[model samples]
Target: MSAESRPAIDGRIAELDDGQRRLLFDRRVGDAGEVADATRALLALVRSEGDDALFDFARRFDGVELDALEVPREKWGEALESLDSEVIDALTRAARNIETFHRAQLPSDVEVEVEPGVTLGRVFVPLEAVGVYAPGGRAAYPSSVLMGVVPARAAGVKEIVVCSPPGPDGMPSPVVLAAAAIGGATRLFAVGGAGAIGALAFGTGSIPRCAAVVGPGNRWVLEAKQQVAGEVIIDSPAGPSEVLVVAEEGCAQPAWLAAELIAQAEHDPDAAVAFVTTSPSLLEAVRRELRIGVAATPRREVVAEALSTRGALLLAADHDEMMTFAEAYAGEHVVLCTRDPRADRAGMRTPGTVFLGGASSVAFGDYMTGANHVLPTAGTARSFSGLSALDFLRSYTWQELTAEGAAGMAGPVATLAEAEGLPGHATAARLRGSKAGEETS
Candidate 1:
C-alpha cells in the first residue's frame, strides 16, 4: 500500500511453503488504502474540470496531447479497411466465435398468464447506446476492444461507442479501431481515464453520452465509474486484474501454468496471479517455470511488481482448503489447469469466470475462448460478474387485463392501496372498479 510499492518491479521469487504464500495473497487481495488519495484526486479533476481535466491527465499519465477526445467515424472505416487481410481475418474469426456465444445469451420475450384472465409478459430491449473503455496501458489492446464492444453488439444495442487513451503521438491505435469496427462499434473516441468516463456519463462536445460504460482501467477508472454510477448505470467498478489457478494432482505442465499466471500480472501492478496446490513438488516446478518464462517477458518488471505485491504459491492441505482459499480470494479469472475444470467449477463459487482444463487457458477466455474477459477484479468477484450481452439490455414487464378481470381485482387493489395510506392510488383503483361494475350490471 505504500507509494514506494506502486512503482514497477519484477518481484523476487522465493521458495515459500504453501501456507506462508497463501497467507501473503490473502492479505494483498483487498483494498490498498494508500492509493485512495491518489484515486480521489484524479476523480475530483474529472468531475469539476471535465474535458480540460482529461486532457491534463492524458498529458500527464499517457504523455499524449489531445486536440479532440472523439475519434471521427471515418477513421473506423479506414482502420478496418487498411489492416492486413490476415490479421483482420483472425479477428473476424474470433468475432464470429465470440458473437455466436453471446448471441445465444440473448433473452427473448416471455408471455405468461399468471391469473385466470390477466396476461403478463416480459420484453428485453437493447440499450439506446453504450460506451466501452479499452485500456491501452503500457501496450496495445485490440483484444480489450473486441471483448468490450462485441457483446454490446450481440445484445443489439444501437450505438456502440469505444474509448481508449491515445498514444504519446496523440492518436488512437489502428488495431483498436479495426477490432471495434468488426464488433460493430458505431463510433470511436480518443478519450481515456476518468474524464473519458465523465464525458460518457454527462456527454461532451464530441463524445456523446452513453447509457452505460464497460471496461477495465487503473484505480482512477474504477473510482470514476463508482462516482458517476448513480447518474448512469455502469457494468461494475472494475479493479486490478487477477487470476487464481487451482492445481490438482494432474494439472498441466508447470511452465505452461506459469505462463498463464504471467499473462494476468502484466495487466497492472496490482494484478494478482497465484497458484494454490497440495503438492510441494508441483509448487517447486511452477516456480522454476515462472523463473524461466518471466526472464523472456518484455514486461518482466510489471509482472514482477504484481508477483511481489500479490502473487502467491499457496500450499493447501487438501482440495477443500484450495477451494476455500479460491472462494475467499474471489478471483476475477479462475483458471483450473487441472484435468477437470468442469468438475472443479461445481465446487468453486467466487470467480468472475472459470477456465476449465489446460486447453482453456485464461488467455483463451480473454480473447477467442468465446467467454467475455472484461470481468470483475480485485476481490470483487464475491459480488460481480464479467461483461456480457445481458449487461447491455433492459427488460420490462407488461400486463393486460380483461374487463371481467379488472372488475374481479379492483376491490383487492383498492383495499391494498388504502391499507398503504395512499388515497390517490385507492381512488384510481376504485374508479376502475366502479366502471367495471357498471359494465357488468
Candidate 2:
C-alpha cells in the first residue's frame, strides 16, 4: 500500500455489543494467516539451524552478522571507556531513578497469626538465576538493560544474566554492555535471537539454564520464549507496541497530540497509535502537529507507516466515551496526559501503565519511571500486569497443623475420602487420627 493510501480509520463513536465491537477493533494477529505462517517459519528456521541458523538469519533480517558468540569480559571496561560521557551520565541518573522505584516494589516479610498456636506467614525470595533479553541489532536501549536488571537485583536475585544480538561491528553494543554492568548483571552472553533464548532455557556448553527469563524482543524472540517456557519461566510474550491517547480540548496541545502518536508508532511498522478526541479544534491541531513533528523525527518512516496502517482518529461525544473506548481497546500504554489519571483510573481497566499528565511521557515510564516495560500487548493487559519485582521471585504457601489439629479434623477428612470412594485415603486419615489420640492419651 502506498503511504498516503494506508487505511486511516475515522468514524463516529457508536455503542456496539461485544461481538460487533470485536469485529471492528480486534488487533489479534492470528486473524492474519500470513503473519502466523511467517512466524512459524521463523521459529522453524531457528530450531533446526541453531546458532549458525541464527547468524545467517540475523544477517538476512537485521543486516548484521557477528563473529563472537560472547562479548569478551574485558569489553565491559572498553564499553565504559568508549561511551560518550554525557550518555553515561544520563544512564547513571536514570538507573538510580529506576532502582529507587523498583526497590519500593520489593516485597516485605509478612508474618500473621491465622489461629492460636499456628504461625502463618510468608517469605519473599528471589530466584537463584534469571535471564534478561536485551535487544541489540536494531538499537541499543541501554535503558532496557537497566529496566530488566535493576528490579531483578533489587529483588535479591543472585545470578543475573544478560543476552543480546551483536551490532554491525560484530560485537554487542558497548552501551548494552555498559548498562548491564551498571544494572548489576553478573554475566553477559553475545548470542541473541531464538538461540539465545534456547541457551538460556536449556543451558548450552558455556551458559546455564536460567530459572526465569524476562525482557522484550521481536516476534521470533517472543516465540522462542513461548517454546521453552515449560522448561523455564518467562515473562509475557509481547507483540507490536500500541498506544491510546485520550485527550480533552482543555489539555490538548498540538505537540502532545503529535508526540504521543508518533512515539508508539516509531517502535514498529505494524504498531498502532490512535487519538480519540472530542474536540474538533483539537483534532485539527493534532493533524498540524503530526505533519510538522513527524517530518523532524529520525524514525519518520516507521512513524508514518504505523500511523497509516493502524492509526485512528475516533470522534467521541465526550471524555466519557473516549475513556470507554480506551478501556475496551486495552492499550499497552495509555497516555492520559490530560488532567487526573486517578479520577478516571476506574474508567481505565486495561492499560499496562497510565502516563498521566504531560509531565510524564510514555518514554519516561519505559526508561526510568520504575514501571516495567515488559508489559502485555494486544489487549492482554486486561488480565496481565506490567513486569515488576514479583516477576523475578516466586511465592508459595505451606501449612503445618498440630497433632491435635490433625486428630480433630480426621473424621471430616475420612468422611470426605469415604464419600469419594477412596478407601485408602480414608484409612490413612483414620489411622493417623487414632495414632494422634493414642499418643495424647
Candidate 3:
C-alpha cells in the first residue's frame, strides 16, 4: 500500500462525527466476545483445579509439561549465576534505578487531629504478598519483571511471587529469573496466561495467593484480572502498548517521528500509534518516511497492520484543537514534540506519562529511565495510573476517640442516623454517649 492510501483517516478536527469520535475514544478492542469466553473458561479451570489445572494449561497452551508449579528458591541463585556478566550488570543497574525512583513514591504514615480529642489518619501498610506476571510466550520480558517487582519491593511487600510461562524445558527464562532476583522477588513460578492470574487470585497448591497482581499482559491475562478483580487488587487494565505524538511544524524530524510511531506499532498488530499536528506537510513527510521505515523494519508486517488499523496521523486546526483531540483520545503514552513542549503543557489533560520535546522517546521511558513502563492502555489512562510502589499497598484509616470526642459525635451521629431511618444506628450512638456519661460520673 502507498503511504497516502494507508488506512489512516486524514481530516480536519471539526469533521469528526459521533461514530468517529467513539472510534477514537473507545477502548473496546474490536469485540471482547471471544477473549472473554476463553478467559472465563481458563479462569474457571484454574480456580477449580488449582495446580492440576496449571499443569494442564501449561501443557495445552504453553506446550510445556511441568513436574512442579514453582521454581525453587535455590534455582533463583543458579539462574542469577548462569546469566551473562553484562546482562547481569545491566539488570543490576536498571534495578537500582527502578528502586531509587519508586522509593520516593512510598507514602509517609499519616496522622491528623481533626478535632479536639479526635485523631483520624491513614496508615499505609504493604501487602503481605503480590504476584507479578511477565509475559513470555512470544518474547522474554526482563523489563516487565523489574517494573512489577521493584515497585512492590520498594513498597515493603513481604513476599513478591513472579509467574511467567515456562519454556520447552519447563523453566522460566533465565533472564527473567535474573531480573526477578535483582528486583527482590521472593518466589518464582512457571505459570502464565489467564491460569497464572487465576492462580495468583486464588491460591494453588504451590503458588501462594497474592493480595494484589501488578504487571502488563495480553488480552487474556488482562481479562482474567478483570474477572477476579474482587478477589484481589489489580494495577490497571494494561492490555497493549500505545503511543501518541503531538508534533508541530518544525518540532521533529520526519524520519525520527516515523521511527517513534513505528517502534510503538512493532509492539503488536492491535497496538495503537497516532500522531496529531497542524501541519499537513509534516504528516505527508512522515507518511513518506514510514513507507521506507516499515519496509526496512524486521516487524514490518506488524507495524503496517497496526498503522492501518488503530494508527492515525490527524490534522488539527491549531495547537488548542490538537490538545482537545488528544484529550479525547487519551492515549497510553503521550509525546510532545514541539519547539517548547512545556509551553504547550498549560491545559493538556494527560492520560499517561508525557514525553517532552523531540528528543524524548517512549523507548527511554520503557527501559532504564527509572519510570514504570506498565501504564494503562485503551483510554483507561483517563482514569487509571501506571503501576508504581503505591499499587502494592493498602491504606488503613484509623480513628481514636476520647470520651469527650465520643460524646461530641454522638448527638450528630444519632440525629443523622435517625434522619436516615436507621434507628439501630441511632441507638448504638446513644449507647456510646450513655457509656461515656457513666464513665465521667
Candidate 4:
C-alpha cells in the first residue's frame, strides 16, 4: 500500500459484456458485516437510552464526554466572534451564493384545467424541521454546513438543526459553528456517528425529531440512515465521493485531468474515479501525471488508496463509446473534457453534476461555484438528483370538479371502474350523475 506501488487499471469497453461493464462501473458503497453490526448496536442504544446513550457513545466512540448534549446559543455567537475574519467572509460569500442558487430552484405552484369545470394543481410546503450532519472524523466540512442548511433555510424550513462530532477538546469545530450560523441553523448538537443519526430519526430527550436528515458521512452514518428511513426521510445514500471524466485527447491537458481525478480521490479511500477516452496516448499521459501528482498531494496516502482500489481508465472505440460508457457509469461528478463540450453534454443522461471543461474544475463546484456539493453517489444519480431547495419542500396536490364535470365523464369512469372489478367505485362515480343508470335501484 505504498503510493508508488499502487495499481491503475486499463481496459477496453467493447471487450466487456453488459454485466462486466456494470461491475466495472458500479459505485455502490459495499457493506461490511462488522460495520453493519456495529451500526445496528449504536442505533439500538440511541433508540433505547436516548440522551444517556448519546453521552455513552460519545465517550466510547468519539472519546469525548458530554457536559451537555446540545451546544448553547451563546456558543454560536462566540464561534462567530472567535473565527478568523477571512474565513467568515468566505463562508458569508459562499452562503450568499448558495442561497441565490437554491432560491432559483424553488418549485413554482402548478394549476391546470384538465376538462371543462375540472381543475387540478400542486402546492409546495416546507418541512417543519431538518437535521444537517457535518462530518468531523477525518476533516471539518464547514462547506457541508453551507450546502445542507442553506437550502433548508431557502425553502423556509421552520427549524434547522446541526450535528457534528466533538473534537478532542469536547466541542464541535468553531469553524463549523460559524458556517452553521451563516447558513441559518436554529440549533447545534455536539453529537456524531450512528448515534447522532438515530437521535435525529427517533427523538432523544434533548434532540428533537426531524422530518428529514440531509448530509454526507462515512459507512456507519449511511447505514444508520437506511435503517431508519421509514421513521424519517433521508436525502440520499451519499456515502463517498466519485468522479468520471470523458475526454478527447487533443482537447484536454493530461495534467489537469489527472489533478481532477486525484482531487476527488483524496476525499476518501473508497472514492471512485475513472476516465474514458478514444486516445490511448492520452490515457497513458494522464496515468503518468497521476503518479507525479500523488507524490505532491497532501493526502497522498488517501488518494493512493482510492485510485488503486476503485480507479480505472477505459479505452472506448470512439467519442460515442466514451459518452456511452460515462452515461452508464452514472458518476457523482462527470467532467466533459471535449472540444465540443456543449454538444457532448446534451448526450450525457446520468450524473449528479456535470462540469464542462478542463477550466471548470470539480473543486469549484464543491465550494464556491454556488452549485451543491451534496451529490448523489454510488450510481444513485440515475434515479436521485443532487440535493436542492426542492428536497426540503413537499408538494401536495389537489383536484376540484363541478357536478357537470363529474357527470360528463360518469359513463367512462364507471365503465373503467367496473372493468377493474371495483363496482363500488363505479357506483360512487355514477351517483354524481343525473343521467339514466345513475340510480342504484
- lDDT tens digits, residues 259-335, model 4? 99899898898888888889999988887888888898889888888888788777899978888888888889999
Cα error of candidate 1 at position 263, Å: 1.2
lDDT per residue as tens, model 3, 165-250? 99998998999988988989989999999999999989988999999987888888889999899999999999978888899999
| Candidate 3 error regions (>4 Å) | 1-7, 16-20, 431-441
Can you tell me which runs of candidate 4 are displaced by over 4 Å?
1-5, 11-23, 420-424, 435-441
Candidate 2: stretches off by over 4 Å? 1-7, 15-24, 30-67, 109-113, 117-121, 435-441
In the predicted model 1, the residue pairs found to clash are: 9-305, 10-304, 11-304, 18-315
Question: How does candidate 3 score on lDDT?
Answer: 0.86
**Per-model root-mean-square deviation over C-alphas:** 4.3, 3.2, 2.3, 3.0
Model 2's TM-score against the true structure:
0.89
Strongest candidate by lDDT: 4
Clashes of 3: 0
Residue 385 shift from truth in candidate 4, angstroms: 1.1
Q: Which candidate has the highest TM-score of all? A: 3
Per residue, candidate 1 scores C-alpha lDDT tens digits across 1-441 of 223222122222234456654544453434545555666676666667777887787888778888877777787788888899988988888788888999998988999988876899999999998999888767777887888788898898888888888887676788888888887888888878777777788776567788998888777788778777887878875767888888876668887788888898888877877887777788778877787767778887888788877777667777777777777778888888665668779887778998888777888777787788788876667787778899999999999887767767878998998899988988876766687554854
- Residue 374 CA error for candidate 3 (Å)? 1.0
Cα lDDT of all candidates, in order? 0.77, 0.75, 0.86, 0.87
Quote the lDDT for 62 in model 4.
86
Clashing pairs in 4: none
Per-residue lDDT tens digits of candidate 2, residues 1-441? 235423266555764455535533676554455544555665565556555665676576556666656667789879999999997888888788877888887877777756543456677788999999987654676777888888899889999988887766766788999999888898887767766777677665556668998888766677677777787888775667788888877775768767888888888776767877778788777777777777888987887877776777667888788788888888888887556666877566788888787666888887766677877777878888887888898876656656666676679999999999999999877776897554864
* Range of the 10 consecutive residues with the lowest summed lDDT in candidate 3: 1-10
